[model samples]
Target chain A: MIIRKIRGLFNHSVALVASLIMFIPVYLVVVNSLKTKVEASSMGAGLPTTLNWQNFAVVIERGKLLTAFGNSVLYAVGATLIGTTLAALAAYVLSRNRSRFNRFIYFFIIMGIAMPTNFVTLMKVMQLTHLINTQIGIILLYSATSIPFSVFLIYAFVGTLPRELDEAAIIDGCSPIRLFFSVIYPLLTPVLITAGVLNLLGIWNEFLLPLYYLNRSAYWPMTLAVYNFFGQFESDWSLVSADILLTILPVIIVYLFAQRFILSGMTAGSVKG
Target chain B: MKARTYPFYFAGGALALYLIFFVIPSIMGIFYAFTDWNSYSTEVNFIGLNNFRTIFSSGAGQNYLHFIRNTIIFTITTIFLKTAIALGLALLLTGGIKRLSYFHRVVMYLPAVLPILVVSLVFKSILNPATGLLNTFLRNIGLDFLAQRWLVDIHLALPSVIAVDTWRGVGYIMVILIAGLMAIPDEYYEAASIDGASGLDSFWHITIPLLMPVLTVTTVLNLLYGLKVFDIVFVLTNGGPGRATDTVYTAIFDEFSKGRYGMATTLSTLLFFIMIILGYFVIRLMHRETEG
Candidate 1:
């Protein structure tokens, strides 16, 4: 009993130390974001002598965060809706039919999960399509990039759903589109939500796409905006921290709420369970 | 009836978008790799083996091969580090300590959820050589000699980048591993114990064998993510301290920005083929798992 107790205590301390190591960076950001310029210069982990509530306001005004925030919302939401819906439709038919061609298409699309974006040639395609520096272009790109993983998740999910639902609707003389929208689509809620939330967060946190394509600040997402803000205010740790805080605040909130789905979704295909 | 119920056009939207944006560009990149496609001129000249030769030859200042070496090192190191640490955490949380395990898992996984840019930027501040938190704490603890330049030194830069990335990524791998660990039945261990098998023996016999599939999945995931790593290295070092940390992706970006489109496409094409070949095996493995 004494040995077991000692073992338990040792494990607990190890877990605690690990968690602290993980949380310290976030802790540092939270504390330094509220400090004065001089105190925040080093970006230390010390507590603030006084909480500067106005720092957020200062960052908002100077960082153009409002526009960036709106743009992020637009991109994340717009892309999630389009990407998830299209992926579901595609995954459903491919899973249901199981034809040689459909199977080939399914593999082809999901192969993108491992495929790296050839950005240099993608530039030419973007210009040819006249999407370079456009908000709509960014949305389409995010949606396209998201299709691979979304399709993979939703494809696996489509298998768990019985095919009887499809036959039943067909026997009722329902149109194909009607059967899908009215019956099959509604049953896909859980997977849709999982795919949607993951894509939302993924698109929200994305930096590379914007860095390569979106040159105009008017269409910059929070990630790009915060990066630019850091470049300008690199020395001002307080303000940079504030900018980063505001940028990630939404992502943290969403993750906390939808973490159940996010965690399950992330682990879905990797583990059999 | 089959065609009518599940119309082929339903898949058309995703197929079209993917082909146009994803596939076509990659195919075009293969062609562009052999040309002197640049922003300097409208006419793209065929420069057959020149770009490939440049990457292979390693001229006076060009370190294309070095960049590839750095990427391989980053990928291998991160995979080993993340897998080992994550496996330990998974075991600890699953069997070692039962209390507040969920809370601990959540806290650990927080960094993976945050933007890599944010994490790298914050790490930039923490890793500062002078008056930085790491150096300050080291000096305060009377270990001043232990404090060294974290990101500036060429030899230390890649390792520092790898360490920061490991910190951000281990939790994610741990979550997947926790699931894998939890799925193993308790009976296996109990049976082993009854047979007089020691703890280490059972772990080696039971847990390791059972967890092979998940381990393979996690390793492949890590491999893919590591090969394409850019954001962390970009924000932290930008392949800095004299290109000591430039990976393939960052090197591509550098070439692209320099208007050397031919070289950029060549490098991108190289990674593309490597990933596609690896991706082929990965998809086969994953597909088999789902099917079986």
Candidate 2:
């Protein structure tokens, strides 16, 4: 009994230690971001002697975080709404129809899960369309790239609903569009939130696409802003840390409030698909 | 409002966006791969297999073979470490530690939620050779011999990149495994205990077999992501210390930057084919499992 008690305690401590190890990087960023320039250069993980909120102000000014933050919100929201709406509409069709054509299209979208976006060629295509280095371009690109997964996710969820709902709505003198908007779409809230949150997180955090497309600082997203900021402020650890914190702040907040939905939604897609 | 016709209308918007941006670009990518395309060239000429030959041959300091080797090393090592550690952590979290498990899960998962760029930048500073926190912590604890130039040393750079990738990734995998572990019924363990089976015995006999499906999913997910990994390598090393950490994706990016558009497309085309083969197997496996 004593040995068992000791073993349990040992395991718990081991977990605690492991958790602390996993957290040290975050802890370093958070703590150092609040320190003065001198204190930050010391590179110690200790708390600041005084709470210096000036770091945030400096990063906000230098990094142009406000503009970048706005761009991120616009891109993420625009892309998510467009992708999700299109995907939901398509998913409704794919789920309801059992035709060979519909099946083939559904399978084709599923193949995109394995397909990595070829940004090398994508850049050339973007140039040809004159969409390179533009917010509209990034939004359109994100929406397009995100369609496959969004369609697949919504298709999976839509499959779970009974065909009776569609039948009942159709018999009640409803057009297909009206039937979708009034009855079927309401039933898809859970999966919509799932797909929306997942895509929002993905588009918001995406670095490569925006990095390649948006060369202008004015149109840079949050991730790109942080990257460019780091290049200019590499010597100033405190400022860079502040920039990092600010960049992730919105995402962290969203994740905190929607933790349950995001976690379950992420795993649900993987498991079910 | 014919039901059948409505379906076509519904799919039109998504199909338009997908075809123009995704499908067409993919096709264009391959076609361009066979031509001497570059930013400087007004009209691309057919180059046949020359771009591929450049990669295959030892000319122009291409280091193509090295990139492939490094990619395999990075993908395999990181996947192995990430899966093993995630499984270990999942087992521990599920091993009757009830009250604080939620807190632990949230804390561990916190990193995975942060942007990969942020994670890479944070680690870039943290692993700095001079006055970085990691080395400072090591020295403070009298482990001075263990410290080395982490991201810059040719010998240490690739492994350092892999370690950072595993650090950021293992938490997400652990959450997946935990979800898998939780799905497992407790009755099996209870019965095993009643029959005088040890903890290890029950874990091996019951848990391993039952968890195979989830494990396969996790493994394939890791492998797929690993094969196409770019963000972390780009942000951390930029495939640097003289291309020591270069993967195929980074190689493509570099060639594109240097106006070697045809070469870049060749690399991209090869990667696409590899992905298609992998996708074929994944679809087959999933279909088999679902059917059975």
Candidate 3:
């Protein structure tokens, strides 16, 4: 009995240690983000003797911080607004009606998850649309990219919805758009919020796409701005850390505020369940 | 459901965008995969598998193979470690472990919620070969010999990426599995305990079997994620230390940045094909499990 208890205790400790392991690096981020440059270097994950807000100001002011924030907000919101509706419309059609396009779209949306960002195609698309350095360009790209999930999530959720509501509306001589706008749109608010939030997190924290496509200095998003600001000086660790922290804070806030919804929605949206 | 043409119009607004945007480009990508189309060129030619040929023929060929190999390596390692660890935690979390259960879930998922860029930069400092916290901890524990170059050396770079990745990601896999466990009933456990089954025996008999659905889903998700990973690699090594860390996507990024559009598309095509096959098999496995 003693031996069993000891072994159980040992296993329990190991599990707790494993859980702790997940936090150490994050602690590293929070800790190092607060330190002065020299202190950050020599005393990694150490605190700064005094607080410094200059790094954040540098990122926000000269680093075009407000513009980046505005771009992130605009692009994410724009993409979500237009993209989700477009996807939901397709999903409604696919879910409620039987047609050749339904299967085509079902297959198309599935294929989207499999499609990695084709850099070559992305470059061509950008040049073709003059999206090279514009917020509209990025918004369009993000919107197009988001259709797969948006369509799929709405498709699955819309499948569970009763058709009597739509049929009753049709009996009342409602147009298709009116039937959808008045009936389906409000019902899909749960998934709309979920998909919108998901797309927002992805676009808000996006880095590489903006790095490649959004090359104009004025149109830099939050992610590109943070990365660019970080590289300006190898020795400016405090500024770098501060910018890094700033880029992260908005995302963290979003996650915390909507944790339950985000958690369930992500699982519902991603899992085959 | 009533027979209605209205659904078509509802779907029409969406189908136009999907067709014009996603469908056209996807097919175009496959077509461009076979061309000699450079981004800087005014004219292009049908290469007829020449790009694929070039990818295999060039010195960069071996690097592509190495990336495929390393990706498989990283995916398998992390999946194994993550699945085992996540299931273990899921079991414990379902055990009603007092106040720490909620705290553990919150603390554990904190890293997963952060962007890969944030996680990568923080670890860059924490694992610095010269003056990082990890090595400092190792030294203080009187294990100086245990330290090596974390992200700078080829041998350690991939391992470092996996460790940092596992740190940020295990919680995500864990939470999903926890949800899986919670969905499993308490009666099964009570019934097994009444049958004189030990905890390990019951977990093996009940928990593992019940969690297989979650397992298959998470594994496939993890594999898809691992195969296309660009941000972490881009930030951590930039496929550095003699290209020891290059994944297929990173190689494509490099080619794109270097103005080799056709070649990047070729790599993307190969990646898509490989994933389609793997994802199909995983789906098939899950389908079979569900049917049974």
Candidate 4:
């Protein structure tokens, strides 16, 4: 009994240490963000003597975080809605019908989970489509990029739903569109939320897409804004930390609120149960 | 009846966008890889195998092969490190610890939710050689000799990037492994114990076999993410310390920024084919898992 108690204590300590290591960087950022510029220079783990709340205001002004925050919201929310809705629609039809062509299409789309974007030629396509450096373009690109995984997740979920619902709706003279939106879509809420949260967080944290495509600072998202801010104020650790804090604040909030969905979505296909 | 209720056109919107934005660019990239496409040149001249030659052959001041090597090394190392550590953590949380295991799991997985760029940036400060938290702590604890230039030395830069990546990623892999571990029926362990099986025996005989599929999924997921690793390297070192840690994706970005579009496309096409092959198996595995 004593040995078991000791083992339990050891395990708890080990878990605590691991969690601390994982959190140290965040702790450093939070503490340093509130420090004065001199204190923040090293970005140490020390508590600030006086919290500099003005750092946020300075970062918001100098980094143009307000515009970036708005852009991020627009892109994440817009892309999530479009991507999740379209993926749900597509997954429903493909999973239900399961025609050979549909199967092929489903495979082709999910194969993109491994497909790396040829950003060089994507530039050409973007320019050709007049989407390069445009807000709508970024949203569309994010939505398109999100489709594969979204469809994959929702397709598995679609399989779990009873086919009786679809049959009943069809027999009641329900049009296909009406049947999907009015009946099947409501049932898809859980998976839809899972895919939406994942996509929203993914889009919010995405930096490379905007860095490659969005030239104008006005269209830049929080990731790009924070990166650019870091580059400009590499010396001003306080302000840079503040900017990063603000940039990731929304993501952290969403992750905490929707962690169940995020974790389930992540492990959906990887683990059976 | 199926066709009437579930129309094919419903998939059109997603298909169109994906094809245009995702698929077409990749196809066009293959063609452009054969051309001398650049920002400076308006005319894209066909130059077969030249970009490929440039990548394969060692050139003065430009080592495309080195970048490829770095990418492969990064992928392999991160896979090993992440899997080993994650498995350990998963086991510990599942069997070793009982109290607050869920809370610990949530805390550990927090890093995965944070943006990689932010994580890297934060590490930039923590790993700072002179005044950073790590070096200071090492010095304070009388471990001054261990305090090395984390991201500055060419020899250590790649490892540093890999370490940061492992830190950011291990939690995610652990969460998946935990799910995999939990999926195993308790009866297996009970049966093993009844048969006088040791813990190690049960782990090897029962847990390993049952967890193979999930392990494969996690390995492939890590492989895909590692091969395309960019934001971490880009933000942390920018493939710096004299190009010590440049991966294929970072090198592609470099080539694109330098107006060498053909070379960039060539590199991307190379990764595309490799990933597509691996992705085929991954999709097959995932599809089977979902169905089963």
Candidate 5:
């Protein structure tokens, strides 16, 4: 019993140390964002002697911070809406109606998860389609990338739902579209939210695709805004940290509210996807 | 359910977008790989195997094999470190330290939620050679010898990038693992203890075997993510200090930036083939698991 108690103490200490290590970066970002440039570059996680809003002020003014935020929201929400709706609709059909063609299509779509985005070819395709730097073009591309995984999630969820719901709706003289929009779609709310949030997180945080596709400053997403601003302010640690903090705040807020949904959604994606 | 054309309608929008954006480009990538397409060229002429040959012969100051080697090394190291640490964290959080598990979990997952670029940018400053927090902390503790030019040192640069990747990745893996650990019933552990099994003994005999499916999934996901790493490495080191940290994806990015479109497609085609092989096995494994 004594040995067990001692071992328990040892385990807790190790966990505490690990937790602190995990938090140091976050603490550095938050604290240093509020610090003076000298304090920030001094490379300590110390609290600011005085509250400093100048760094954030400078970042916001120079980085066009709000526009970037709007762009992130526009892209993430647009992609999620289109991707989730289309994926869910397909998943419903695939769930209710099974055919070799459907199965093949499902397999084909899910394969995108494993394939790296062929940007070299994608760039050419985008250029040819006149989607090189347009927000709508990026949204369409994001939706394309998101479909495979979202379809997988909704498909798995729809499998657990009984077929009788569709049968009942159809027997009530409901057209297929109305049956889907009224009965089946409402029933899929839980999984839809899951898929939506997951795709939102992914689309919002995605950097490489945006960096490749969106070359113009006017169309830069939040992630791109942060990257470019960081380059411009290479030596200004305070402003850089402040820009980063601003970029993550919205995500952090969303996470605090919907962590359970987000966590389970991600796990479900990996495990079953 | 009877056969209906409705299913096709439901899937058409997504299918069209994917075909236009993803599939056609992927197929074209193969054809383009054999062409001499570049920003400087007015006409894309067929140059069978030229790009591949040039890459093999090290035309871009970065040999194809060097990128592959660096990619494999980085992937394997990050996957190993992330999986092991995440497992450790899950074990620690689930075993006897249950009270603060929520706090620990939230804090651990905080970094995972941050954009990869944000995380990388913050760490670029944190790991700065001279006045960075890491070195400053080291010196303050009288361990100045430990400080090195993290992103600039050839030997240490790759490992530093790997560590950062592991930091961003481990928490997400740990959350999956904790859920997996939670699913195994308490009776198993209780039964093991009642049978005079030690903690380590139970962990080896009971915990590991039960966690195999989850572990397999985690490993495969890690392998895929590690194999395709780009954003973090790009933001952090930009494959710098003389190609010390260059991976296959970054090499492709550089080629694309340099207007060597055909060369970029060749590298991408190579990566695509590798992924296809990996993905085929992954699908097979999933099918087997589900069936059994």
Candidate 6:
């Protein structure tokens, strides 16, 4: 019994130590971002000696950080709307039918993961279409990419749903659009939220597509703006760290508020991702 | 008749868009890979195996093969370590180690929510040879021998970058494992205990086998991402320390930046084939295991 108790204590401490080690990188950024350049250069993991909030202020001022933040918010919200709606719509059709066409289409969408890296010709196509460098263009591209997983995921859940629900609404004199919005849409809210949260994070965190397509600094998304800040001051560790922390803070805050659906949605996607 | 056609109308708009934007582009990426399609040139010519030969032969892209090797190393090693740690931690968090599960989850998961660029910036500063937090602490405690130039040193850079990536990624794996564990019924462990099974025996016999499908899926996805890694490497080393950390994708990006469009597409195609083949097998193997 004594030996078991000793082993338990040892295991507890080991786990605790290991976890703390894992968390050091996170804690380091949070603490140092609050410090002045002098303090940041010193770069201790402890609290700032002077308790400076000016680091964030400096990053905000130098980077037009609010404009970038607002731009990202606008871009992410729009992209999420398109992605989730397209996904849900495609899912609805696939779920309601037992046709080979639907299955083939559904499977085809997952290939987006396989081959959709940066395509310069696609950029040229966008330019020729006169959609290049516009927020709408970026949103359209993002939504297109979001379809596969969305359809795949929503199809899995939507299949378990009863078709009679749609029929019941139809008997009550519902138009096709009304039937979707009123009857079926409400039923999809949980999965929609799952898909929405996933889309929201995905669109918000995406940097590559935006980097290629959106070149205007005034319209640059949050990631691009932060990356630009890093570029401008490649050797300035203090300013770079400060900007990095500021950029990640909003996402982390939003994530804390919606942690539940994020994990489950992400896990659900991972099993097939 | 209108109702019969309603479903087609509903799926038509999104399906058309998906096909045009996704399906067509994917096929086009492969076709372009075989041609000498430079963005600068007005007309492109066919370049058969020249681009591929460059990757394996000793020349401009020889380092990409090294990057491929590094990426493979990072992916395989990180998956093994992250899965082991996540599983053990998930076991502990599922009421075994007792209490503070919520607090621990939030702390561990904080990294995953942060963007990769931000994570890289944080680590780049944190891993500096002088006055960086990692080395400072190591030196303060009289463990100076362990300190090295982390991201800049050829010997230490790739491993150091992988370590940071693993740190950010473990929470994701742990959360998924926890979800997988939660789905398993509690009665199995109770029944096993009643059969005089040891804790280790019950874990190995009941818990591990049930978690196998999720684990397989997790490893596959993580490994694929690890192999095709671009963002973290782009922001962290950008194939620095004399191109020691160059992954094939990063090399492609450099080639693209240099206006070597045809060569870039060649590398991209190579990556596309490698990932697709590996990803297909892993997904099939996992799906089969889950169904069986």
Clashing residue pairs found in predicted model 2 = none
Off by over 4 Å in 4: none
Q: Sort every candidate by DockQ, greatest first.
A: 4, 1, 5, 2, 3, 6
Better candidate number, 4 or 6, judged by DockQ: 4
lDDT per residue, candidate 1, A1-273, as tens digits?
999999999999999999999999889999999999999999999999999979999999999999999999999999999999999999999999999989999999999999999999998999999999999999999999999999999999999998888888888999999988999899999999999998999999999999999988989999999999999999999999999999888999998999889889878968876
Error of 6 at B161 (Å): 1.6
Per-residue lDDT over B1-292 for candidate 3, one digit per residue giving the tens place of the 0 to 100 score: 3335455556565566555556665567899988878868877788898877766765744556677787788888888887887777777776735446766776677777777887887777778888878899899899999988899987899999988887778888888888787778889999999999998898889988987777878888788888888888888888888898888888888888787778788888888778777756754564354334
DockQ of each: 0.87, 0.61, 0.47, 0.88, 0.64, 0.46
Best by DockQ: 4
Give the runs in model 6 whose Cα sits over 4 Å from its true position: A1-19, A114-116, A234-238, A270-273, B1-6, B59-61, B278-292
Q: Show model 5 residue runs off by greater than 4 Å.
A: B57-61, B288-292
**Model 1 agreement with the true structure over B1-292: per-residue lDDT tens digits:** 6878899999998888899889999999999999999989999999888899999999847989999999999999999999999999999999999889999999999999999999999999899999789999999999999898999998999999999999999999999999999999999999999999998998899999999999999999999999999999999999998899999999999999999999999999999999999999999999987897
Top-scoring candidate (lDDT): 1
Residue lDDT tens for model 6, B15-109: 77676665555556677777787768889888887777777776863566786788788788889878988888888777455556766776777
lDDT of 5 by residue, B1-292 (tens): 3565244788888788878887898899999999988989799999898888887886666678888889999888987898899999999999868778888888788778878888888788889898788998898999989998999899999999999999899999999888888888899999999999998999999999999888988899898888888998898999988887889999999989999889899998988888888887877776555335
**lDDT by residue for model 6 over A133-219, one digit each (tens)?**
998888887787777777766877786678788788788888777877877788888788887877777787878888878888888
List the candidate 2 regions with Cα displacement exceeding 4 Å. B1-6, B286-292
Error of 1 at A11 (Å): 0.3
lDDT for position A118 in model 2 = 77
Clashing pairs in 1: none
Give per-residue CA lDDT, model 2, range A1-273, as digits (tens): 998889889878978988998888778888999988888885578999988899999999989999999999999999999999999999889877858888788777767777777777888789999999999999998898789888877887787899887787777877888978888888999889888887898898898898788888899998999988888988888888888888887888888887787778757655543
The clash count of every prediction, one per candidate, is 0, 0, 0, 0, 0, 0
Lowest summed lDDT across 10 adjacent residues in model 1 chain A is found at A264-273
10 residues in a row with least lDDT, candidate 3 chain B: B283-292
Clash tally for model 2? 0
Q: What's each prediction's TM-score?
A: 0.99, 0.96, 0.91, 0.99, 0.96, 0.92
Which of the two candidates, 3 or 4, achieves a greater DockQ against the reference? 4
